[model samples]
Target: MDARTQWDAGRSEEWADVTPDAARRLLTAAVQAFAERGYHATTTRDIAGRAGMSPAALYIHYRTKEELLYRISGIGHRLALGIVSRARDGGGDPAGRLSAAVQDFVRWHAEHHTTARVVQYELGALGEEHHAEIVALRRETDAAVRSIVEDGVAAGEFDVPDVRGTTRAVLSLCIDVARWFREDGKHTPGEVGELYADLALRMVGYAHK
Candidate 1:
């Protein structure tokens, strides 16, 4: 099957009987297994064991490891896109939208560190066909940010010479925060989000004064 078909098929699994709390446990276990054992090495049994469910029970929810991985990855991409969409719909100027986007990006990654880690590190572990779907989602995210930067430059709200490069820099800055941010770290998620928003604004040549 093609990537979109594969993703759609995977998402069609029935979670109607699964309570919100149980669903969270399942996703949490999936993320931990993917992160600890790597996607290629993780199995449904591994996740089941981690979540204290039987292998048969796990199968009832997820037929394969790839499906679980796709679900986790898909959620991360959707979360990022949702944040950007909300910012754009907020009817703000370029700088306000950019600041909102940056804040949302940082906060999401900080709160969902394991999900972010699995999304970033285990993408290659997806089946070749499934990898394409994930890549497409990622590209859409890149394009959204690039378009934002281009709009900012055109509107004279920012002075970036390279929209693509600036977009990559801004995204990388947010994505990498998951690698080092800790709940007990010197900065809380809100603090880190504001700091990164400031840095991203400066990078795009927005005057913060």
Candidate 2:
């Protein structure tokens, strides 16, 4: 499916943890504002206005605008980690697991481009502690991919010489989808996922089946 379709299909699944209707609206608005104007440029009033709530209503749930960003980034990172974790935990040899991980990871980046863009690109706006927490979550995600590559290397299923660097490349490639993907683009999320799965497998020297 196209990124838009994919996003709509999976939106609730990714964001279901966020509670209360007002908080959800505020978060939704913050995502748009942050994606369009960057975190530093977006104000709580703008977010509240877009959410159809008064400015003071924003502080009822969040202490500051940074807190709003912290909540969004936290949820986004958790969702990313969950995606990789499920793909890793699902049964497969190294090659199979790697393909599934890459496909799912890439598809999430494409389908959730708006929030993903803020999560991947606009994190610098977060407080130091918040940013550090997100970084820790991201490290777990890296380990998920790296572990698959490591398993493949050990089993002689792949020929990657630099496991750590190769793993980083696989994730970096997937994360870049947020930067350039458009619904009007030639490929849909599923198609892009398939392509990335192949590329990720090739990266680890797993010959196409």
Candidate 3:
């Protein structure tokens, strides 16, 4: 239901709200298909087959493969926005807030790397309108991180000379985790999250007490 729950729920279970169970299965299939084969390379039949449904059944739930991608992107980005925004709005020392933000953000990327890989890397496959909508959500994510950096600078908790650039770097670092993280990796998602959080603090020149 909440962003944290969705993040911890793996790829398919995050679609709990998607009606008809069949639709959810399609989404789950789409995520897997796209992540493995890429949105452009993946076919409607491929998605349908993975979901155990016929090709026509995919149209009953989603108009096109792009639409399915848009839905996945929208859901994933909204959850990501919630994570960063909550950390920004949470009342705490700027250092603490920034660390929390990066921790949770990185954890989500690692925990759901499969779906995340599709949601993040498949942006170029979306239609024009869908692309614009997802971009708008991304800008909000940028703003949320920037605000945290601004707060840190204001409170003398960090020494970031270029708040905007540093915000992008922080977000890029967290988001890129989805690109390389593996379930069988040396570190767990929580360990990766903690490492990234500490690295983010150092990036801002936060002096740990």
Candidate 4:
């Protein structure tokens, strides 16, 4: 069987028997283990232990470590894309939309640091076919950001000379925050969001009103 087909077959079982809260806890533990130990080093037993569940219990939810990692990484990208999509759909001036998008991205990364870290650092551990699926999702995210920037530039709200490069810079800046931001840091997540929104606006030449 092909890799994609094999993956689909493996994931075809219904997990409706698992409670939403239990699944969330499992995903949380998986994210922490994947971030701290990396995909290759993280074992299902480690995630199960951290989540206070037995390995068999975890297996009832997820078939393997790879499946857990795949789900986390895939969800991270989807969440980011959803934020941008919603911001665009809100119907505002270019600057307002851009500010909202940046804030949303920053806040999401701060709130889901473990998932962000795994998505950023451990994606390579996915099998090649699964990696391609995630790569496409990431590309869609990049495209969405670029489209926002391009729209702003065309609308005369932003003065960036290179929309693509600016999009990458903005994304990188927000994604890296998951690496260093601490709950007890000098600035709260809201403060970080505001700061990043300001910086992103300035990068695109949108002066604060």
- Residue-wise lDDT of candidate 3 within 53-85, one digit each (tens)? 999989999999999999999999999999999
Residue pairs with colliding backbones in model 1 are none
**TM-score, per-candidate, Cα-based:** 0.86, 0.96, 0.94, 0.85
Expressed as tens digits, the lDDT of each residue in 1-209 for candidate 1 is: 64334333433332233466555567778888887778878778888888888888877777788888888887778778778777766766788888888998887777666668888878887888888988988888888777777778888889998888899999999999888876667776767889998999999998556
Backbone clashes, each candidate: 0, 0, 0, 0
For candidate 3, list the clashing residue pairs, or say none: none
| Colliding pairs, model 2 | none
Query: What are the Cα lDDT values of the candidates?
Result: 0.78, 0.89, 0.90, 0.80
- lDDT for 121 in candidate 3 is 90
The Cα RMSD in angstroms, rounded to one decimal, for candidate 2 relative to the true structure is 1.4
Model 3 alpha-carbon drift over 4 Å, by segment: 1-8
- Model 4, runs deviating above 4 Å: 1-21
Worst 10 residues of 2 by lDDT: 1-10
TM-score of 1: 0.86
Q: Considering lDDT, which of the candidate structures 1 and 3 is the better prediction for this target?
A: 3
Q: For model 4, how big is the CA root-mean-square deviation? A: 9.2
Better of 1 and 3 by TM-score: 3
lDDT of 2 by residue, 45-132 (tens): 9999999999999899888999988998999998889889988898879898989999988888888888899999888888899989
What candidate 2 gets wrong by more than 4 Å, as runs, is 1-4
Where does candidate 1 have its weakest 10-residue lDDT segment?
7-16
